[model samples]
Target: MIINPELDKLYNVRAAIPNHTDIFADWEQRSVEFSQNVKGQLDLRYGKGPREKLDLYLASEKNAPLHVFIHGGYWQAMDKSQSNFLGKTFLDAGINVAMIGYDLCPDVTLRELVEEIRRAFVWLWNHAEEYGYDQGKVQISGHSAGGHLVCMLLATNWLSYGLPTDVNPIHSAIAISGLFDLTQLVPTSINAKLGLELEEAKLLSPLFVDPQNICPLLLVVGSDESSGFHQQSDNLSVGWGENFEQLDRMNAVNCHHLSVVALLAEKQSSLFQWAIRHLGS
Candidate 1:
């Protein structure tokens, strides 16, 4: 870890949350129950890789917009199973939800994980008609490392991806408790797993990337989260101005890194409601 005491506290999410394990355990149990109870396609392969599968939960038989959610594990730890509960909010609102998973770092470079996410979107677009979703309306949301990946997706030019010019694959995006500038991460203990250099971090950071067609960019972080998370969201909103028609940030009240994500499961949560509104528009 870096010699900076404050930086260590800021970046070490598990250390910050003493009971993070229990939180995740509950998440796993709840996610399993949700998956068993909900009816939709499970373990759908988005890419050829073993880890590049996604779970899609459709609310109704009729067509609706799709909400693509990415799970965060600092690009290493978690998978989409813990994220299945997130789809309930969108499903209750009569929307389809797809939770994406990617190969972790060290095993596969972060760059390749980004490509896998792009390919996941490619799969979604190609299968939209079959899935009974509106291809043009996709609202992207991610937490932590997933947030970073969401920004990368936002910056992507769909035309280069062979997407139709008339159709917009991404309508709006939300980054929840995300780390935007990864340079700070390289010096932290997490770098052991991320294996990131300052140069590579800068190259992939949404802060530096030029966004393609700006959508409504919403940045969010738990108020009780470490200062690093708040600064990441604030800084990205300031830096990615050109990529968003309107920019906003939500300081989730009395929540931490893990708890803030719980807000996504709450129908009345400002964050969840905000996502629903933007997705409908």
Candidate 2:
């Protein structure tokens, strides 16, 4: 399995490594187990639509820190249910995990998806008491398209959302193997589903946005990722400017875009443990 980093692998991760059944199988197996074995709420609606729902896994610690994970399916194909396995480790670390779902592309524009993400967090913050999670501190992490949405959330104006002005709803974030520049996808096969013209692509690209008021953010990409993927992660850190100095880093290491996020399933993996520290903060 010699993965050439410079190869012409497009944004579609599954295409690079066609045999991803094991990865998805492990996710499904773990997710189902965690969902059944753990005590949590499922299909909790944050918006009027049916797809705008979230799942929350509770931790032993009362008022535990919160972590929200968004699933990646290029904004069209996946659901929060597929990633419940992520909640297992966060729960063990005494952080509540909220897996959010959204209406997909074509049916709903990327702009609408962004608003859905914003509304999802706002719902979490407002209903923290019922969920038994701390509202004071929150961290976020997303893989692939989820990572893209994570950055938009980081750049969002919480105040405009009627969230507390004293503290940002998000305290820390990590975007794993995420696509930051939407324009890059315009010419790719994914664009057929995304339908992004140059203007729409630029308008939605988090890489081009300056997230000045955000908390600490870490951009990670797989060492075996395509050159385009690597470029996006690096550019995001640089675009953050001085904030990059605080947590300014882009981590590239063993795995491809798909496999990189699979590290989340390993409780002791560097990516998971590193995220645990962020939740503690």
- The prediction achieving the highest TM-score against the true structure is 1
lDDT of 2 by residue, 146-168 (tens): 99999998778777889867777
- For lDDT, the strongest prediction is 1
lDDT per model, in order? Answer: 0.87, 0.81
What is the C-alpha lDDT profile of model 1 across 1-281, one tens digit per residue?
Answer: 45456677798899989999999999998888887889879889988887999988886746688899999999988999888888887888988999998899889998899999999988998999998988777888999999999989987888878888775678888889988898878877778877877899899898888887577878999999988999999898888765566988899999999999889999999999899888773
TM-scores for every candidate against the unseen true structure = 0.96, 0.93
Model 2 off-target regions past 4 Å?
A: 1-8, 250-252
